[model samples]
Target: MRHFSSSATRTSRHRVIGALTAALLCAAGATVPAAAHSPATPAPPAGAPAGSGLALTPPMGFNNWNSTHCRAEFNESMVKGIADIFVEKGLKEAGYEYVNLDDCWAKTQRNADGKLEADPVRFPNGIKAVADYVHSKGLKLGIYTSAGTRTCDSVGIPGALGHEFSDAQQFADWGVDYLKYDNCNNLGVDAKERYTTMRDALAATGRPIVYSICEWGENKPWEWAAELGNLWRTTGDINDSWNSMLSIMKQNLPLAAAAGPGHWNDPDMLEVGNGGMTDTEYRTHFSMWSVMAAPLLIGADLRKATPETFDILSNHEVIAVDQDPLGKQGTVLSSDGGRWVVAKEMQDGSRAVALFNETGSAQRISTTATEAGLPEATAYSVRDLWTHTTTNTAGGLSATVPAHGTVLLRVAADKHWAAYPPAVELALDGSALVEAGRTAKLTTRVTDLGRTPATKVSAALTGPAGWQVRADSATTAAALATGRTLATRWQVTAPAGTATGTYDLTLTTRYRAPSGKQVRSSVPFQAHVVVAPPAGGGYLSDLPRLSASNGYGPVEKDTSNGESAAGDGKPLTIGGQVFTKGLGAHASSSVEYYAGGACSTVTASVGVDDETGAKGSVAFEIWSDGTKAASTGVLTNDMAAQSVSADVSGAQVVRLVVTDGGDGVDYDHADWGDLRITC
Candidate 1:
């Protein structure tokens, strides 16, 4: 579903937005240039610069790729239904205007008249009919095509690579208001020239159309597309996963200076309600996208979206930051201690700050007004956008952010007095299951939830008698700011003769708050230790493991997915450590196992290994005697290894199959670690 950026010259040329704006104004009423061939270009006529005044702000809308992925079910009726949801669900009122058709909307070939035709069966009333419907509903219609001979999806329909003018005219005649021009099968054509040709064609039609260049950031369009397009895709497609979402945000946030006003950097689409991440992560996703001024296109099934999704998508105050008249993308002020702080300069001289906790546990985050680009030591009033609560910050704001969450605030100068004390919370990230008499590691992350910084931060761990916890049971940490996190790991080992059962763990953290007061907090948790069975079988990890004997290829050590392919091999990382011993297979591909039979269950932790967009997308399935027993939901980059189990009693053979999740097999590098069959 994505075409990542290929190798290109690392050019660092920079062009200001004012220059591009001036170029558009200068090109008004100019004659468009003709292309080199029949499909390459069209005759010149009335023209202007590309995408001028069309995307003064990032365009908000709904795209259909993440939801259906060019299935046969995509048709005019589906478009109409989504258009209705745009209005009926109040999305249109929330500023989501464009109802875009991504791919597979056209016929395999042009009609006898040499015109692109809508699929007769799927779009009986034609593209114009759907456009009319969206317009009537007070929304714009967006269509998709490619700069290559075939679209990225290659749905059999020809792309607009060589038919710039003709396709532009057809789209204009159909009343299309936006075009998502993709880059697929382009045969090494210069991306800039190819897209510019269509830009001129659209402008020559004397119609206002938003030109969205979908080069997948391969050519660094952010540096050159300002005058050629309204918005350009800065990365590959986005999937519904926490890792994918956060990775995209991390990549786009650094390119903020490349965005402003009309020319925006698109980070694909939103995956808020796709069930890939928690609601907390969705808020962070929306908050990050808004702060970066990225397009806010919803990519979920709107007809059945939950209220939580609607609330996240329809947050007006957050939307205001995205649509700010200043049109400046936010900048990251700090990214230390698992806390990411972003500050966007508003038109009214105020700053919109987003404090994000990227840890897996709740953390206290704080920053002073000066650190957040506001006047230092000056009284300021803080408004929490999500909570809609206004409070006075003596110098800055602070709050305790949940795991993978964010706190959005609008800070302005005020002569008020309010002091929020620093607070600390602790969370542990490690396996709940531990091997008796063996050593295990657990990471403790402490977060500050007050407005001021906490100093003298240290932690200690205590467990059952005869148990040993090593590696800095008393560890010191750097000063922690509000919303910031400090992580420490402690190794715990039980006595060799200790009983196998659940044991309690206590983590006591001692710290000095901003007020110079010492405080201590205790967190009680549990870890289970299961001893190896005295007889026949144990976890495969305890014994020498064998690779696939059939239905697979070479088994390389430390390889998870595959190599140089969608199912390419990549290593598995757990708790930030690479687990070299595991199983890796491609979709429709399997690894056989003979770890003995008569076992009560087969268990293995599964997930994708790579972080390269959809190439790491896959579903892990376990099969016994040609029948499915256990499977996991589609795992992307963000999802960590999850335990997948199935009954295998009386079984002699079992296999792990990594299949393309009902879609064509692409990035199906599946990982199954600690694979075992136990009685």
Candidate 2:
């Protein structure tokens, strides 16, 4: 239900581009200021009838927006196929129940009777037929429409603004069970009045259709939408990237007081299985959404989803947290640097704790059960949702989470503590970059945190095919007593012709539990394969980066930081100075290039891009190998371009990083202008 224009071609009946652009510009940057609402935001009046009984918890479903996005493949067959996959892939059993259709489902114009009509070619059987099919699968059907004269699709299908009653009646007649009303092309109408009209119209139909207001939190919906819709969006659209997901999460995590049964704060849809992030990141995405009690509407194409995607979607433990009858949104307990600790109260007196690491390196995050709001007890049961393993902890809960990963734990007091396994933690320490044909040594430390000892503990490391991996020291031990650790070292060798990029390795650790069962934990490890650049001076943009991650869109080669769309940037400009060659990136971004141990120095002019108009703040750092070689403490848009030079002799990889300057990443567009490297 995002309010962004799609690439669908418009019909002659639609308004002109100039008019649409004017409307879009008016709605641009409509996000409500943070001061407008907070965790203390009051709830709706009691006995409010809007969405009184529907969506008692956050909705769990699939919306065909992020994946197909009005493409040719987004047809009746695809919707039916998704419903079928819901049933066939255990998603239905896991508590997902809705099959939602997004924009471009309707025709450009209404029918002769002034009623909305489904696209004939895309839905030959009409929406009613698709709704019937979805209902037959024991799932609800959700349809999308804007509150203006046209939908978000560039083709401009009929909206429900003036025809609210008629469209609501038509959807009711079609057996639609959910409605995602978006905000686009509203013609400057008041958001509340526009959405209220549709709400009243839907209620008059005498059906139980769930109303989801997609106003992008422009008017502080959390302060007023609880009495009007079942769920209201609290942020803009979500893209399938870590920074996009993290930024949205930060925006939505502060409005916990506005969410509850039948009324919730929607942070947009799930981006799992979208392929933009690693599986570890997807797990964190799912875990955080569940902890925050956000709608679990999947945004991936189910017909082509991988097994890993299905696994993340169908995790019953995580899903239960999202669907908890308590309906309390998670609140941030602590946040320092890039580490976050969030906790949610469940219906049965349990607390769901998420130790999230947003940094670019592995970190040890810890939180006590008492700090998580659990009552004092002799022992607590710590359940790892992703690993599906339960362990007994005296009081402390901790994990060494990977970069952009989460350790989701459900902590609760348990009387039968001896029945569960002892908690064993794993941590990996070693270099992250290795030259081709060279070897690197990595160490894994296993510790027993439970009261009892873990027997026959062992660890092993495995790399990609054609790469050599072996244990350099003892990998097994008789037993690891409480608070004791066993460290093992492994030697890894990349092939001589290994590609210059990041490679994944798995570190698996196993131990025998008190119940005589084997417990296994597998952690993902990344190693960069570097080959120095050609022995010459050249622009840094000319070389292929080993890895790149931007906060907004893809890092640009030679332009200013633009919007969320790739290749939309202009000439790179900093403090009114334009550069023809540089990297345009957003805050909290990183790009690594293989220096091949040949580059002697790297230089650049770094500053906040003027495109943000004195509204951005960021700090730039250069990392040579694993050490910081140079840094610009903090740069703002008001400052001129500052020169940065880093000594990079014998460095295998050079990394350029830009971080948000203590504040959030709200307009932190940055530019690395005239960057050059000398070898």
Each prediction's TM-score against the native?
0.63, 0.83
Q: For this target, which candidate reaches the highest lDDT against the unseen true structure?
A: 2
lDDT by residue for model 1 over 211-259, one digit each (tens)? 8998867778899998788899887556676645665676588789899
The alpha-carbon deviation from the true structure for residue 414 of candidate 2, after best TM-score superposition, in angstroms, is 1.5
Distance (Å) between predicted and true CA of 496, model 2? Answer: 3.9
lDDT of 2 at 52: 54
In the order shown, what is each candidate's alpha-carbon RMSD?
A: 14.5, 7.9
TM-score, model 1 to reference: 0.63
Structure candidate 2, residue pairs in collision: 532-595, 532-596
Off by over 4 Å in 2: 1-49, 334-337, 359-363, 465-473, 531-547, 563-568, 592-604, 610-639, 642-667, 675-679
lDDT of 2 by residue, 429-511 (tens): 64356677998777878888786779999888889999898888888899988778888887888989887777877778789
